[model samples]
Target: MIVKHGSTTFLKVIIFLTGIAVLALCVWLPEIAIRDARVHPDTAFFLIPFLLCAYGFCIAFSVALYQAYKLLTYIEKNNAFSELSLKSLKIIKKCAFTVIFLILLGIVSLRVLAKVTGGDDAAGPISLCLMGILATSIITAIVDALQKPLKNILELKPEND
Candidate 1:
């Protein structure tokens, strides 16, 4: 059975956006925060972790998005879910967890640091966006996992043919 490749274009665009977002969050944002650290230590603490997660997210997101691209290509060729896809998905899942962990740790650390240094909002929209992105990736992993059984079933050739 031939697989479809129509959605790959969509995936590419998403991957591009995510990459840009990572750059903005990781490199640019952290630098600004660090530069402003003398004036705002509390801000720097939060920004540091945000940078870490952003870079991490960049690497993880790239891998997953690339794998998705590869998966689409494989589908175009009517290949089953190869080890590549499975490995990629596993990495993606791990990345999501890591992001979540880093995020949680950052929040707790920032909250305490904030109280000591006197800052009201340690975490803003950036944290929320990261959490949302990680959550969505997790859900996607679940749905992607379901594809295994279906692919196996589909791969079974008709005996008569």
Candidate 2:
């Protein structure tokens, strides 16, 4: 029990640090966008939608991190197999999907902007967006895989109890 709590504590700390890092990134992004807008005034319009998408991604990431923290807490409390933990997992899965959707939306918007601005250097951003989508998809898949077993366990738990 002590070991389990300690492990969950460590995971919670990691989640906290991750949240802080993402918050810092969210703060730093606006400055970067402002700088980019000043440097390439023509692409200033592009920056707005991109920044919006970035902010949406950050929000979804934060939500997923919070859900993860909740899941860890559930584990520490010996409620790892409970409905609360399952709910947290579901929320995390939804957050991952939301992130993937946001990334796809950003990619599409980027492509449209590039065509409008005659900007041919969109490969880097598009590639990054694709990677984000892939990573989020993996997370979503993992959560989905976990969900089925969790559901089965929950269904059988009442009978055992």
Candidate 3:
């Protein structure tokens, strides 16, 4: 059975809490492990950029979470066609677009940073991941845009049919 809006609201809160917890862990890890650099200096350096990417992901996730939240609220109130759901969907779309843009920017920045830091090795994974994200986001956004209006129309009741 599909979870209802209220249940979804609870899941959204869990998502938020989990996001916050992961962010906090990232922030705390460096300090907590600073003294263990005997074999993990690289871990610390990587953590900085890891945290950056995590925050970027968190931003995207927040957009999605809010969209879910608004959609759930609309479903619960029997007013799914209202502007709030649309607004939330628009925000989600914009956030997805921004994520794609930021991924491109990150690829460029990573290339520059790699050149400066003399580590061509690190660029490969980042470039691969960013390309994947960009491709997926573009496809997902297009599909969502195409199907959403149809979905909305179908949700309407046929008069005296």
lDDT of all the models against the reference? 0.63, 0.89, 0.64
Candidate 1 per-residue C-alpha lDDT over 60-110 given as tens digits, one digit per residue, 9 for 90 to 100: 666666666666666666664555555655565666666566566656766
Backbone clash numbers for all candidates listed: 0, 0, 0
* Best by the TM-score measure: 2
lDDT: worst 10-residue window of model 1 = 151-160
* Candidate 3 TM-score versus the reference: 0.59
Descending-lDDT candidate ranking: 2, 3, 1
1 against 2, candidate with superior TM-score: 2
lDDT of model 2, residue 108: 94
- Weakest lDDT window of 10 consecutive positions for candidate 2: 1-10
User: Which pairs of residues clash in candidate 3, taking residues 3 or more apart in a chain or in different chains?
Assistant: none
lDDT of 3: 0.64
C-alpha RMSD for every candidate: 4.1, 1.7, 5.8
